[model samples]
Target: MMTTIVDLMVFIIGASIGSFLNVLIDRLPKEENINGRSHCDHCGK
Candidate 1:
């Protein structure tokens, strides 16, 4: 049904956004800028 298709689309979109946010969180603390390798929190390097 159309409603089911819309729900699926919304879910997929939300998942994609969540994935991007996860990447940001994983990287941002390792960096002060937009692009950097994600690293462990315990080490300063």
Candidate 2:
């Protein structure tokens, strides 16, 4: 049971980190300022 809980925590952390990296990968190509606020591509905010 303890091992199962630890495994779940690890999976959650890995998924969160992967999602953050995915955002960086998606934004870096078209961005002139990496620090700038992100907006939706379709809305053009």
Candidate 3:
């Protein structure tokens, strides 16, 4: 039971990190300023 709980915690942490990275990947190409708010490359809003 303890092993299963540990595994679940690890899985949740990994998934959360993966999702955050995905957002960066999606916005990187379009956004010029990575440090600031994520927006479109063309609009530059």
Winner by lDDT between candidate 3 and candidate 1: 1
Candidate 2 wrongly placed segments (more than 4 Å): 32-38
**Candidate 1 lDDT by residue in tens digits, 18-37:** 98898888777856554665
lDDT of 2 at 6: 100
Q: Candidate 2, clashing residue pairs?
A: none
Off-target runs (Cα >4 Å) in candidate 1 are 32-45
lDDT of 2 by residue, 1-45 (tens): 999999999999999999878778887786645566777789979
TM-score to true structure, per model: 0.69, 0.72, 0.66
Give me the candidate number with maximum lDDT.
2
Clashing pairs in 3: none
Ten-residue stretch with the least lDDT total in model 3: 32-41
The number of the candidate with the highest TM-score is 2
Q: Which ten residues in a row have the lowest lDDT in candidate 1?
A: 32-41
How does residue 21 of candidate 2 score in lDDT?
A: 85
Cα-based lDDT for every prediction:
0.80, 0.83, 0.79
Off by over 4 Å in 3: 32-45
Judged by whole-model lDDT over C-alpha atoms, candidate 1 comes out at 0.80
Residues 1-45 of candidate 3 have per-residue lDDT tens digits of: 999999999999999999878888876786644466656557867
Worst 10 residues of 2 by lDDT: 30-39
